[model samples]
Target: MFQLGKTIVSEDIIEKEFVCNLSACKGACCIEGDAGAPLEENEAKILDDIYSKVKPFLRPEGIKAIEQQGTWIKSDFGELETPLINDAECAYVIFDKKGTALCAIEEAYNKGIVDWKKPVSCHLYPVRVKDFSEFASVNYHKWEICDDACTLGKELQVPIYKFVKEALIRKFGQHWYAELEKVAEKNN
Candidate 1:
């Protein structure tokens, strides 16, 4: 359903239709840390620096949320992975007394005290990046697209894509972007 230039995501890509049904579903993708994604070295550093600078301002609830969800651990492959969650929401996510889910990082960013944004893993849901080792590449797809009744499957997933792409470009410079373009072209 998300089409930008030649980037076309057809419904066939969906393996299941996830209805989101946030009221009951708990928005696991947003909160759960270790589904399967891992951060690149550059990404990890940027995230660490930004959060480190903002940590002091984080509310006590924010600290509790992070601790409850579990922190990132270094993988054998050297990537940072949050503990995989099967059903629990992310630790940093808190529901208001009214039951609306809240993002702690979004709160910090909105306060104007810190610009700490969501990490790439959090931004890109179904799509994930894996190092080629031989050469860098950008792999984009709707891996988690579902067919059941998920509103998100019919909605746009590209903003997340753009955010992830932009962050990687900013972190690694232009060559990385060029490689991404190449990978995209080859895949399409």
Candidate 2:
């Protein structure tokens, strides 16, 4: 790991390649996870404030889950996160006609119904951030489900950092991302 500003970033992000091959994975990350998507405290409040607008884009089961569980819930571990349906799929998960899971909140954002796209955590998949007292730990998350994505990324020659460039910028900022690029260049 190398330090960038207040973050300790893993070299795997620069070494490994990954691009979401949704056709192969079918958005399993949303529906297959045991826990709901992680959220920040502010994201919870945003969910609460925008539920009504996002509700229409959700599946019936997702809506029911959110309505019964509230916009967000404190996990048994005390982390703030989105709710789940039947303890499986995320409460905000909708699906395209092909049955690939998608975030309802993001659907709303895509339709111009809301300003927020989705939770930063959700936006930054395969790159999980753990905030500490001083620095944030940024690491690539390797999941078996995303093996196809890894293969595709390798074929496309896209590193994980490049694939998630927009999200890294969103989470860290332009200057921080630029520094990361310099570090990536040096590593390469």
* 1-188 per-residue lDDT for model 1 (tens digits): 43423333332223222323455544545554444346656655554556655555544655564455444546566667543334345434556566656555556677775565666655544444454545333343443322222455345443333434555555456674565455445555
Runs of candidate 1 with Cα error greater than 4 angstroms are: 1-24, 32-37, 52-71, 82-89, 97-101, 135-188
**Model 2 over residues 1-188: C-alpha lDDT tens digits?**
99999999999999999999999999999988789888988898898899899888988998888889999999999999889999999988888999998888898999999999999998999999999899999999999999999999999999999999999999999999999999999988
* After superposition, candidate 2 runs with Cα above 4 Å error: none
Lowest lDDT sum, 10 consecutive residues, model 1, at: 10-19
Could you tell me the C-alpha RMSD of candidate 2 in Å? 0.7
Q: What's the CA error at residue 28 for candidate 1, in Å?
A: 1.5
The TM-score that candidate 2 achieves is 0.98
The 10-residue segment of model 2 with minimum total lDDT is: 31-40
- Say which candidate scores most in TM-score: 2
